[model samples]
Target: MPQYSIKDHLYESQLFINRSIAAAIIVTLMLLLLGVRMVYLQVVSHEHYTTLSKDNRVKLQPLPPTRGLIYDRNGVILAQNLPAYSLEITPEKVESLEQTIEQLALILPISEEDRRRFKKLRRQRRPLRQYPDPSTPER
Candidate 1:
């Protein structure tokens, strides 16, 4: 036969109740802190966040920077953008660029080498794509 002392103790109920109260108090404190932080963001730090949000939404540009004159020790212009004329004609503006090139050849001494170089530069500036004119039949 096994003998039992059977001392369950009366403090077990009090210990469980104390632990439950502590847990509830900790949870309530965490929720209180969260609520306080939310209120602080909405009311106290409102303008700061509003300015940042506005800065993202609005695009504010600065004035164009001025180009200054640069000179060397020997009074020579190191760099400058002086008034210069260039024969710039849009490729799309010209109906037949071959005829245009022939006309320009009459005025300027543009060699076959120069025409090849110009075509190379044009290819770099604009992508090569065949645009078939509906008015003229494709050759």
Candidate 2:
């Protein structure tokens, strides 16, 4: 059986000081590592990240070709292109999409349902779509 003194204040303070010095060293190392990483990212890797951000800011999407009616030798349409009126607005071109929609509502007699559908479809950004037959004349 080993017995230790309860009144060892100097030993306790020495242990505390040792632990404190170790903790300080660890914290200082972590801070130095963090600072080095920050410097690398901000200085060395700055241009690479800047170009990536710029590329992301401006995206190029090709417009799909309009499907024209394909005819056979015997005056029969092998394939027919559906009639549709597509309106495309680049988000970057428009300052305010909501305001543009409001302006369009005045001209196009658009309702809340139409506005809601437009908003929903705008997120999709489908360039072209086929519309159902509504007394469409054959071309």
Candidate 3:
């Protein structure tokens, strides 16, 4: 004859319920910790991060210092900076070089010497290049 055994249903149900409660508690605690850390970063340290972001966005460029005048031992000015204006024309931009020069002459005091110099420079310069006219009147 074989021996018979009975299952304890009540004890098994209690054990399963205990394990489920422990797992739920652990998950809830982890979620709470994550929420607290997010709040600290978003509210507490907001200004510090905001300032860093603003500084990164805005750039600072240093301006070049003005050049000083040089003098000789006898107090005579050896070298000094003077402002001068000149017109530059790009060969590619103008449709008719002769017509454009004529029109510019009417508006500005473009003398015969200026015209001749401009023509010479234009011929010597590589195509689509701009050369400063040497005949520009000193201001």
Candidate 4:
């Protein structure tokens, strides 16, 4: 049997209390630092981050000015402007493009000549280009 002394018990209790206090202080400091970092990002750096997020969204641009109208020798409009209707499709919105194209071919009166013309134009266009030519009426 070991004889317990008052000094030994007091020293042990003091050591345990000191370790507990150190652990509590470390945890509290970590929490405070985490809260401060969160506040900084949400409040101080919010505008910069918000702008970055907005930059990722789509941007629209207007077309440049049209060319001058051509005139004949008699000062009459020769190559005058004609009212044209244009339609555009965003590739991101289309699904199953091959199937859609096949369906379109069935619905529209696209001739064999038109398909060949499309193929020739497709070869000339950039690789990333997905939309059909705006010049084509049945596209």
Q: By the TM-score metric, which is better: model 1 or model 2?
A: 2
Q: What local distance difference test score does each model get?
A: 0.69, 0.68, 0.79, 0.69
Per residue, candidate 2 scores C-alpha lDDT tens digits across 1-139 of 8997687899989999999999999999999999999999999999999999999986666666577789999999998855454344565566886787677666666666665665565566543443212122223
RMSD of 1: 15.9
List runs of model 2 lying over 4 Å from the truth: 1-5, 69-139
**TM-score-based ranking:** 2, 3, 1, 4
lDDT of 3 by residue, 65-85 (tens): 368689999999988877645
Candidate 1 structure lDDT: 0.69
lDDT of 3 at 55: 98
Off by over 4 Å in 1: 1-9, 60-139
What lDDT is reached at residue 135 by model 1? 24
The number of the candidate with the highest lDDT is 3
TM-score for predicted model 2 compared with the true structure = 0.48
**Model 3 steric clash pairs:** none
Please, what are the lDDT tens digits per residue for candidate 4 over residues 1-139?
Answer: 9998566888899999999999999999999999999999999999998998888874555565487689989999977666554433444456864565566667666567766766666667665565453336654
Error of 1 at 82 (Å): 14
lDDT of 3: 0.79
